[model samples]
Target: SQTIHQWPATLVQPVGSPLSLECTVEGTSNPNLYWYRQAAGRGLQLLFYSVGIGQISSEVPQNLSASRPQDRQFILSSKKLLLSDSGFYLCAWSEFVAGAVNNEQFFGPGTRLTVL
Candidate 1:
């Protein structure tokens, strides 16, 4: 069975503080990974994604970065946190199928970040 994991179910941090959030998967190999941020009562925003180890793609320009050091490990980091960065961060994984549409993604419980 495949599973996704995220750390620190919730977080409270002051503005300008550094941040590091981790996500990892098990029971899968070379899965497509994604990072998303959802604001209160808003839709999700794709932050980053990776197709394989050492391959990362940023979906939007922001104050954060992502890395895939291992095939099943993804990390999101920032040197300085911003108030606008506060949101529900989600990590998801899906099977990679070439030319496939609507791949179902399994999401982690998510980490709620509150920046003050």
Candidate 2:
């Protein structure tokens, strides 16, 4: 079975501070990893996705970045946190081995970031 883990279920930071969030998968190899942000009471927005190591696609250009350092480890970073950046951050994964376009996304519980 595959499982995804995200750290710091909740976070509170001041404005203009740096941020880092991590996600990792177990029992899977080369899975497609994604970072998503959900504004309060809003739908999800894709932030970045990585097909492989060092290959990331940014769906939106914001004050954030993503990186895949290993087969199952992904990281999201921001140089400075904006008040607008405060939201629910979710890391998701899908089976890359599956030859399907609409693979089901498995999300972590999520990290609620509160910037004040």
Candidate 3:
């Protein structure tokens, strides 16, 4: 079975601080990894995605960046977290099984972040 996880289920950070959140896959290799941010009551905003190691795509222009160093490891980072950066963060993945990409995605429990 494949699974994804994000750390610090809840975080309280200041207006500007370095940020590092990690996401990883356990039973799948070379799966598409996505980093998304959802503002309160708003929809999901794709920050970045990786198809493979060192390959990343940004769906939105903002203060966040992502990287896939290993086939199953991904990381999201920020040099200076913005006050507006406060929101929910999610990491998700689907099986790389051929023809499986057409299926709907399964999401994990989200991480709630509050910044002040």
Candidate 4:
């Protein structure tokens, strides 16, 4: 069975501080990984994605950056946190079959960040 894990289920931080969020996938090989964020009352927005190690694509130009150090591990980081950065961060992995474009995404439990 495949499983994804995210650390620090909840976080509260002040402005101008650095932030780091981690996600790791188990029991899968070379799966596509992604990072997403959801505001207090908004839809999920994709932040970053990686098809392979060191191959990342950013969907938005924000203070957040993502990295895939290993085949199944992804990390999201920031140099400074902003009030607008408060949200639920999600990490997801997906598998594509036969080169299909619309693959179903499997999400891990998210990290809720609160900027105070």
Q: Against the true structure, what is every candidate's RMSD?
A: 1.1, 1.1, 1.6, 1.2
TM-scores, all models, native as reference: 0.95, 0.95, 0.90, 0.94
Q: Residue 64 CA error for candidate 4 (Å)? A: 0.8
What is candidate 1's lDDT per residue for 1-116, written digit by digit as tens?
88899998999999999999999999988899999999995899999999999999999999999999999999999999999999999999999988998989999999999999
Compose the digit string of candidate 2's lDDT tens values, residues 7-91. Answer: 9899999999999999999998899999999997599999999999989999988999999999999999999999999999999
Which stretches of model 4 miss by more than 4 angstroms? 96-98
Better of 2 and 3 by lDDT: 2
**3 against 4, candidate with superior TM-score:** 4
Clashing pairs in 4: none
lDDT of each residue in 1-116, candidate 3, tens digit only: 87777786888888788888888778777788888899986999888887789999999888889989899887888898889999999888766667664845556666787878
Q: Who is ahead in lDDT, 1 or 2?
A: 1
Per-residue lDDT, model 3, residue 98, is 72
- lDDT leaderboard ranking: 1, 4, 2, 3
Give lDDT per model, in order: 0.95, 0.93, 0.81, 0.93
Question: After best superposition, candidate 3 residue 71: deviation in angstroms?
Answer: 1.3
